[model samples]
Target chain A: MLNSMLEFVPRIPIAEGTEWVTEWLKEKFSVLFDPIKEHLGNFMEFMSEDVLMLIPPIIFIIAVALIAFFISGKKLGLAAFSIVGLWLIYNQGYWDHLMNTVTLVIIASLLSVIIGVPFGILMAKSKIAEAIITPILDFMQTMPAFVYLIPAVAFFGIGMVPGVFASLIFATPPTVRFTNLGIRQVSKELVEASDAFGSTGAQKLFKVQLPMAKATIMAGINQTVMLSLSMVVIASMIGAPGLGREVLSSLQRSNVGTGFVAGVGIVILAIIIDRFTQNMNKKKA
Target chain B: MPVIEAKNLSKVFGKNPKHALKLLDKGLSKEAILKEAGNTVGVNRASFSVEAGEIFVIMGLSGSGKSTLVRLINRLIEPTEGSILIDGEDLARMDKKSLRRVRREKMSMVFQKFALFPLRTILENAEFGLEVQNAPKEERRKKAEKALEMVGLAGYIHQKPGQLSGGMQQRVGLARALANDPEVLLMDEAFSALDPLIRKEMQDELIDLQSSMRKTIIFITHDLDEALRLGDRIALMKDGSIVQIGTPEEILVNPANDYVERFVEDVDRSKVLTAQHIMKRPETVNIEKHGPRVALERMREEGLSSMYVVDSKRNLKGYITADDASAARKNEIGNLEEILKNDIPRVDKETSMHEIFNIIHDSPIPVAVIEDGKLLGIIVRGSVIAALAGDAEVNIENA
Candidate 1:
């Protein structure tokens, strides 16, 4: 599996078009473009609303802080010192731009959960849903990060919308994969106990089964956040601003120091997000 | 009349018909269910009714239908065929709403793994069923507290299942079931996962609880000792079918088949039997010799039951009660006390149960063993037979 994955990893970036090999394979499987376009359209409309763009990210930042506090208490304040340190080193003010990335990432993640969880449940319930979905998940996951930008740019043009859009597709598969896995892995005995004790289908899903699968689902969320953060730098090459744009501009002008600094900023952001989400999962568990 | 009845209950998996025309079909046969499952025959055509308040046990080995059978009683898994009637209402025929209502209102089940909802505190786990049924929050909370109290987990209500010991987790499961206050409690080998000592403690606790609550219980187990300890009538199962359904005494004495007889023969009857089995028969002699006068008087006083007679050594030889001794003289009376022989149950303290059983079976009277008999114990024929059976507890009445 590892050998195949590594060998396939380089194959994904080979848009060095196959002039000889099978045109039939390309045309037969080319239904993804239109749906991807419609999704990009819906995403742009959703993000255009001020409340949709503004309030949720702010709430998410607060929720992240609250989660941090609950786990390590006033220790979270000490971590904020590094945040200030990054701002000083970047030289340019990053508060608004960082907030935009946070906002867009949060919105994408929320949508992933909303869409992914139901898809997961449907997939879990039916073999046909699983059969259709599992291959799509493989394609989404194995397809190159850079390849996502090509279509995202073609469809949504360039903005925070496309950045969030690419991140959603990349990040969503984890949540959906893990949700189905988690729900399916729950002990049959527990499900029977719930049913035997007279839990309605809706009640069983929400109360008994969902809660039991929570730890695994939370793990999926952690994976999603990490995957979304990974897309942030790549998405910056298109036009989504934040640390990514700084890295791009720094590299373009050959300001190696500034680019390195921006790279450090993204790495630090990933670590912080990763740690906080993991800690939040621990607290919930 | 029986409170619960299963009419030819059967279950089959796969969409394939028994005799399939299409090659795509998975064959429907025991071998097919086995090869596909490789190790399960959840339930078969099992039919039995538990009288209200009866401790009905369905006993089987793993992969036997005990779990699936009880689940069928409550319709947890919809039976592939047949119907389940609870108090004259068909559970299998009920609509979803009525089925759920029956579950919430009539029956609650406990699981082998505890399944106590680790995400919730003990109180919340107990209250989950009530909450699902849409009970008032305060009422449910109060009821959960009461249940916790009943299970002796009162102080631990706020603790999660992860924090509790296995025994305590099972208590929480029990508390959760009891909180709903249903008429029937289905125990799916509830104590099977616990340590032996904990299992014993839980079994004793269940007996104590059932004594007070009198819930019509359908308990499943593979252990004959457990079946004997807990059940009023045990249904011995092999594969998916019930081999025998009887009190422990009946099952022990007269197992319907060799499989059941073999199952009972290996069980330790000592754990099940008590002094009640070999008690001295009822006494009919007066305080003195020549005590009774007429045949009618002897019949009225003795009721034909035997009385025990002992020598100076306290050794029992044989017994002749007023009924037999009175036959010696219809017109005249005899020394009723002296005339009666001591035929109380006799055996060495170390007498093997098989020997004792054989002796009792052949004799019309209970055998009396003598060796400085200080009246240590007597084995009643009924109880000996009971002890060898599946779920009969001995009841001893001391003189």
Candidate 2:
């Protein structure tokens, strides 16, 4: 009886629908999307391949260590840890791969924040926008990150750009969600008070709303960075090269030791970025 | 003309305000109107005027719409019906731009929560109103500094609002409004959040500020004591409608209805009622109009040990006792000034009964109520004691 009941449930055509949508978008909007793809590709290459590689390895290590130290309020311990961590990745011969992953995460996270914050503010201001965007955010967050790669590759075609495109979708929801939540959480009294003082709409937004929502927006940025890093290994499957590629190849060849070392390198990089951003948020507050 | 006036004002907080108005016109209660129309009446057909430099208080309990009324004066919440006129300019008819100008230049508001910007320093918060007006940076800083000094917050100019105590933060709120140099101020329960002692201190500070600044103010409060202390004339509200409008003594002595009577039932009449409310017409012998013989006869008829002496113009000169009057009459003295005693205790009509007690206790005669050297009335110790004891006969007669 259970088998017959199960058989009665029709399979929905979700994958076919997704394929058609991607194809239709690519066919109709290629002119618009191609430039964006080209620019992002160039920018990613410049950051990961050109500038990072051109700089002497010792100088690069010192710069990263300095950034970590300054942003974390001169925490010598964290700076030393970052220096040691980066040195180990270099010693283990994964320095270039680490740089590639760092560039991808930076680009993806920056794009996410730039796009997500305004949408989040829109959702905060307008009920219709909130109603429409909320379910989209939920789908983006809950849907398997791996599922996004199919359409990313379908449109952009196998490369670092597609990897970034895939990771962008996986990472944007936090900034959008948190920016909306932060603005919404602002006390009604403060908003009314601002209005009562005859603050223009723009003044109120820049002076009151944005400043009050800083910590939360920073929190969103932090989450976006973390989520972007998490997508590195998945993105490598679409030909994006990074520590993720190292891990993927190790998996394919069943080499546990190489994968573990690469994974540790990613974790160290994440901790360094995370602590810097969190400290920036605290300083702002 | 009144600086601010609201005529037939009403505010209903829902979609079906038309239905709410209909129900209200039929003389239904706020609850009934709300029930029938799915609209909550925030303020109902409220009509009052605040004169220039006067503190007009709108007082009620939490749900009685006192806050809503104050907001309506500034058009913070647009009224559902009627019109508001500030200096005879219809606020209800002004465009948004003009309204913004009015808020910037003509009127300012202080909130109950001490709505200082959390991120801005005390000086910056004070500069907010001036900045909104596009005041130049130098001018804004100067004006904000002056205002902060006025509010006794000059020492903490660079400190954020969160660093201050609740009382100090509220002072910053006041400084923000004052910096604008607005003609009228709208305070919506501005001190209701403070501790009791701080609230009293703020009230006294506001009174002192009002005397010096003389700015027209519309103040809202839920506490009867605060209303009595701060308001020059108060309009008591209940269920979104004003039940009575009177001076504090009038409200105490002659409550408009049962509700108002009960509202005042718990009030200490000695604290609120003034000598003017209990004073009676003084039995006087005019020095220019009567001789010492006449003064003696008048004192005898009134059964008084002494009587006030006023000039022909009713200017209070002094008092003369019956013994002095009799001595003057026997000695054939014509000038009554010789027998007049200038030490008779005199008080202003505005002096509260609490202060009158001390003056009346040591006085040999009734305390004469004088304003600007003109005798208005005399406050006898018995009548004051009677008023304070809440004697119905005394209150009724005074009313």
Could you give candidate 1's per-residue lDDT for residues B1-399 as a string of tens digits? 788889978655455423221211343545556565443345667899889898999998876778888888998777876799998999999999999999998999999998877788999999988998999999999999999999999999888899999999999999999999998899999999999888878998999999999899999998887887888999998877788999866676577998887777666565434344444443333333334454336556655555454444444434555566556566455655545554355676556556676567666665554446544445557656545533244443331
TM-score of structure candidate 2: 0.83
Fraction of native Cα contacts reproduced by each candidate? 0.81, 0.63
Scored against the true structure, residue B97 in model 2 reaches a CA lDDT of 83
Docking class of 1: medium
> Highest lDDT, which number?
2
Off by over 4 Å in 1: A1-70, A73-85, A89-96, B14-40, B269-307, B317-334, B338-351, B355-367, B371-377, B381-399
TM for candidate 1 is 0.79
State the lDDT at A204 in candidate 2. 78
Q: Model 2, residue B373: displacement in angstroms?
A: 29
Error of 2 at B168 (Å): 1.4
> What does TM-score give for chain A of every model?
0.74, 0.94
Interface RMSD of each: 0.9, 1.1
Please provide, for model 2 over A1-285, each residue's C-alpha lDDT reduced to its tens digit, 9 standing for 90 to 100.
889998896898997887898899998988877887898889889998888877888998898889878877887988899899999999999989988998989888888999999999999999999999999999999999999898888778887888888888999999999999988888877887777878887877887888899899999999999999998778999989999998999999999999999889888888888887888898898
